[model samples]
Target: MTKRIAAGAPPGLHRALSIVEETAEGSKLWCAAAAVMACTGGRRGRAAAAAGLASVATAQLISNGVCKQLVKRRRPPKEWIPHDEVEDRPDSSSFPSGHTAAALAFTVAITPTWPLAGALCALPAAVVAVERVQSGAHYPSDVTAGAAIGLTGAWLTRHAPRLILRHWL
Candidate 1:
């Protein structure tokens, strides 16, 4: 099902999607959020960066450490993907997508403080989510679960500081 869905994509779009997928690797999306925040300068900049980074970390833990550990599902087989796109895939269990999780985490966490930046990130985040499935790195359900974790992590990061401060005051 997933293989067919991915294979049906327009031939012209494959290269663009592959490029987006590659550029989103590792901490690039999260770091981009941080750089945007920092460029704004002052305390707001620092707070946004801190929140985005913290949320991404939490989401990564939930997606990779918790959900992936519990699910233990294999990625769509390499043969199911385009020959050119399979080489860079990860060896980890594929359930919730860590890439989408981090993309959403940074996007969501930054929204409260920097709405414009959040808006800009929405495109890349969406692309990353789609690419995870298209690249055979995740299933649709895996991407959905990852998005949930990202939102939860962003909520926690945004509110936890206030929750802690209440204990002191």
Candidate 2:
């Protein structure tokens, strides 16, 4: 699947995906979006931004810190990717894609508070998932696992406060 995507994607798409992946490094894209939402979007936007940021942080810690530490899978082979970006992939374990996790975490966290914004975020999140495979950074299963981790992070972020309150009250 990685080989087919790497080989089949056109140069234009490859360039676009590379740019998206680069922009997403360190969660810059999502942070910028959060800032925008906080500044321009009213109360709902602020809530969504907070949730999204929290989810991203949670997902990052789990996927990059814990899960990656436990799993020692290697990235897809360079030969499988036909692009220059393959050389830039990190040497970390590839059992889960941290980038995909962060992206999905942000998108899912914001959905309930701001469905339209969540819909907008979905496109890039999906792109990041595909780019992980296309750039030889992860296998499809890695991205899938990352996505699951992301959803879990979002769920925790969204419900933890309520659950804590319910327990206390």
Candidate 3:
């Protein structure tokens, strides 16, 4: 993983992170989802969006939890200074990044109804994953695994809303 970063992180990763971190842009995505749900009279749409958010959060936890426990990798050595360009500093395990996991999970959940939105979400996720490596907070492999966990969780969450409503309705 280190070797890969050493070789080179992807192009435009820094720029992508910058775009996502903005308060307006990031919040807009959430607002858009909320608006879409709200417009449908807060029935199935709202329920699904809420459930999807929870699923993404849960998936991030599981992914980060399992990976951290298994890998038990420490942060980069103190002597090692991260790439100057990377801004986010996460003082956690250097495996299966939580941010990447969360982003991918959210992307997965939103993709079905809003393909364009999902694609937009993915841009930041990819950048954040790369930033995790540049910031010395995650190995490339760790980000990859986190992404898998997130995507799987998002998919599972997608159908969970219907099952939940089935009982209550």
Candidate 4:
């Protein structure tokens, strides 16, 4: 399965992933921005934080619990994967990437309030995607699926209250 995916990827994707991972200024910006959003008391800011956190949590639950067990794919052995600067080697199955999912979820949740937040999330998300490759944990498609799940989760969280209200009232 890994061989099949690797064969189809565009050229130099690994290099692109490395470039994305090496940049940290963007992530710092996100952390500071997320802090500001948490503290601002603005309705939009609060909503971003709430939706972002909730979406990420929900996405994680679905991916790690349901999808992983269902897919049951193995990660590339440490021997075959390249060395990288990422902080940790994830223990989970590699079919859907959790980091990429969370980063995309953050973007989805925060973009409405802070445009930069979404772009900034992309930096780390890109890193996570690359790290998966570098760490030999996932194929590009798996990371892509994880990101889609997160984005969908974020979108759902943002609109859920209104949907519920309409249904209930």
Reference-based lDDT, each prediction: 0.84, 0.93, 0.62, 0.66
Instruction: Say which candidate scores most in lDDT.
Output: 2
Q: List the residue pairs that clash in candidate 1.
A: none
Q: After superposition, how far is residue 94 of candidate 2 from its true place, in Å?
A: 0.8
Off by over 4 Å in 2: none
Scored by TM-score, the top model is 2
Q: What is the lDDT of candidate 2?
A: 0.93
Output the lDDT of residue 169, model 1.
83
Clashing residue pairs found in predicted model 3: none
Per-residue alpha-carbon lDDT of candidate 3 for residues 1-169, written as tens digits (9 for 90 to 100) = 5545633644466455545544223334444554665466346555546654765666766776676777776765543534554334455567777767776777677667655656766666676666666656666777788788888778778766687899989
Please give the TM-score that candidate 2 achieves against the real structure. Answer: 0.97
Deviation from native of the Cα of residue 11 in model 2, angstroms? 0.2
Inter-residue clash pairs, candidate 2: none
> Model 1: which ten-residue window has the lowest total lDDT?
80-89
The whole-model C-alpha lDDT of candidate 1 against the native structure comes to 0.84
Pairs that collide in candidate 4 are none
Query: In candidate 1, residue 1 scores what lDDT?
Result: 70
Residue-level lDDT tens digits of model 4 in 55-115: 7777777777788888877676554543442234556677787666766777778887767
- Tens digits of per-residue lDDT, candidate 2, 98-127, equal 999999999999999999999999999999
Whole-model lDDT, model 3:
0.62
Candidate 2, residue 116: lDDT:
92
